[model samples]
Target: MRLVHVVTLVSEDGAYGGPTSVATGQLEECATRGHEVTLLSLWRGGSRAPAHIGSVPLRTRPARALLPGRFTGIMHPLLVGDMWRSMGRADVVHIHAGRDLVSLTALAVATLRRKRFFTQTHGMVEPRHRLVARLFDRLYVPLLRRARGCLVLTERERRAVSEVIGPQGPPLLTLPNGVRPEHDAEVERGPRAPEVLFMARLHPRKRPDAFVETAALVHRKLPGVRFTLHGADEGELPTVRRLIAAHRLWGVVSYGGALSYAEALRAQARAAVYVLPSVDEPFPMTVIEALSAGTPVVCTDTCGMADELARRGAAVVTDGSPRAMADAVCEVLTDENRRAGLVRAGRRAVAESFSIHAVADRLEEIYRNL
Candidate 1:
């Protein structure tokens, strides 16, 4: 099958995060299976986008910010030329949709041409009460109803999509993000320096400030222990630095500016524990990556996978409080037997449930059905 993915933005900083990563993973999987796949998205910065993902083609246009600040990732819609000639080649178009230009354009093109398409919102299009969200739902929900399937990560997300689509809409499919399998030669992990890591975009919703606070608490308990923060700044770096300075956490905590995807994997492999202080993180791909790397995880109870992770001894799920997160990280660092158990169980959990091969098989089946 000729599969085409419309991921919104491919900025230099990887500011698009999970949605882009997931879409490319599928694109590479399809390519490996001898299917012709293409990634169509917008790009920014001087470094230049990659030529391809594995063997799949990567086609892009420059992304320009019409509205400034946090809204820059979504470029002006008119920047792209008519891709009807391009969209005409696909058997199916898979949109990593949100209220973004690339996704909307593909939806419009596919609809006008009567082509089959699927949407996976990646927790972006919730039933938000804000004026922007309401306005977007007006345009997006109708296009969603026309899709072959609307993929959601969690049950809450399913309800959110359902509420927006009303009583009748597209077939809502539950498809979790899949991690690519690691070789058996992967490195072993344990308690080490940089005992805790907070890796994700340093945005307000992700609660990077809370991580800083947690670091201060953890430092007070274990003076010699270290904490590291690694991610691109999404308008919150200044605040994070201010908090770190205010708390006098200069030596106890270090900032490792930004990490590439490969760097992130390596960092997780060596770290003792990975913590994401964010609440309502539906399914944290970062935690899964850490688990796959044999590192223990610390996250909030509000995560979609928290119950399962905690039950299976794969992670320590807390109440998202700085105090709670600090306690969890310290425990993971000091408790040898418990830490090993978490590593073993986390790897097991990832292999059993989050493998990319199974997701690829299901996707192929879905494409054929469509």
Candidate 2:
């Protein structure tokens, strides 16, 4: 099978988060299975040429500002041309983002060429603002409807997209993002420290402030607890810094900015508990990585993987609040037996469902049927 994957950005460091990670993992797995795989992405931070993830080929174009907004997608004529050419040669086009301009361009080309294309909405269709939601409904919803199939991380997201696309929208497939199998071995070795770690972009949506508040609450209960916050500052660095100072958590809480992929996996392996306090996170790769490392996870109920993890007894799911998150963390920290059980369950869950090889096999079936 020849597959062409279209995404907004491709970074070795996972600067753009889970979507990039998912794309890289899936393409590599596809290539390993002897399927021809090519990635078309916008290169960030001054990448000149194509890079490879294993045998998969990644072609990128430097990004340029065409739209005016914080989350608005960029434009590159060369990328559009590249995508069009790739689609012409590929058996199927797999688009990774829904609301971006690159996705919109791919949709147009696929429609014009009458090609079969599948779209995976990385939970981008549900905008926070009413005005933006309305804009997406008008402009992006139709593009989604044109796909042969649409993929979502959770059933909740599928239902939401179904509401917008009505009865005649493209069929929605519920597919969770996957983690690399190498992390599974890390689960055997026990955590090196009694640390609670938060790793993601320090942005408003990620709720780094909530993590800080939760840290303070957890520290009040477990005074010896160490909290480490990792990831590059997006826009909420000042807010996180202010909260850390206001709570006087300088000694208890420390910020480790922007980790490499290897550093991140090592951090996950060494941490006792991994927490994601973000709201409406659609299948966070961090959660999967943490689980794969046999580290117990505490995340908000709104996270896409929350239900599945809780069902497997792999994590403690809480409401998106500091008090609730703190309580969940304390529960994991205080009970040695519970923590061990969670670690066991988390490793089992990842091995059975979220491994990249298994996910790629399922995806191959989908592509063949299409």
Candidate 3:
């Protein structure tokens, strides 16, 4: 199979978080399986190119139009023609980031070429959109309808997109992100002291403040317990820092900066309870990674992972409230039998469902069908 993966950016250090990691993992696996793969990405002329990716051919082109100053918004019409010519040689064209100019160009190119195109919509165009963005989408809807299939990261997103596009909505397929298992062998067990960990961007919707307040509440009863926060700030860091300082939780609550995939796994391996504490999310890969690390998770029932968590039997899902999250974490951490059961279930879930190779098999089937 010959496949072309089109994304505006690819982070090699695993610094950009889950979506990048998932795409890289899947593309690399496809390359390893003796399939021909090509990567077309926007390369800002002065920026450094990735040093290596074995056996995969790559093409880098300068983005035609830069909008919001630094971001790629719309591609030049001529560039879309160039992209179409490139896709003419491939069996499949997979667009990873659908909001970018490269993606829009790919969609247009795929339609004109009558090529097999598949799109992975990370999240539906951030609910509130600029007028220009909406205009672009209106123009692109027809192209989306012509796609071989549309891939949605979560079931909710699939349903929402179906409603928006109606009969013209391309055949929707929901595939959850895949994660590699962190621990190959049994990790050394230590005396489990209950500690809560929150790992996500400090964005408004992530509700990091709620996580902190919940941690304070949990600390009142479990005096020795600690909470560790990870991930780079998006905008809510200042508020979270203020709350942490005012509470004099400088010692009990620590902020660990964004980490590599290995570092995140190490943190998850040490945690007694992993808390997502998100107000809303679209199929978080972190929740799956925490489960893969054999840690019990406490997350909102409103998120994409809620149903999966219940089915996996690795987490306690409650309402999207700090108090609810705290209570769930406390319940799991305080009971040895319950925690142990969750750990066992979580490991089994990852091995059976979320493993990279396991997901790649499903993806291969999709590619064949396309």
lDDT of each: 0.81, 0.83, 0.73
Q: Please, what is the TM-score per model?
A: 0.93, 0.91, 0.84
Stretches of candidate 2 off by over 4 Å are: 46-50, 127-139, 186-191
Sort the predicted structures by lDDT, highest score first.
Answer: 2, 1, 3
lDDT of 3 by residue, 87-147 (tens): 8988988877556666777887777778888887766444336787677778666677777
Q: Model 3: how far is 178 from its true place, Å?
A: 2.0
Off by over 4 Å in 3: 12-16, 42-49, 52-65, 69-88, 112-114, 125-130, 182-194
Candidate 1: count of backbone clashes, pairs at least 3 residues apart or interchain:
0
Scored against the true structure, residue 179 in model 2 reaches a CA lDDT of 83
Per-residue lDDT over 111-199 for candidate 2, one digit per residue giving the tens place of the 0 to 100 score? 77777899887786653457866775676778778888998888778877777778888889877788876765644465368899999
Pairs of residues at least 3 apart in sequence or in different chains that clash in candidate 3: none
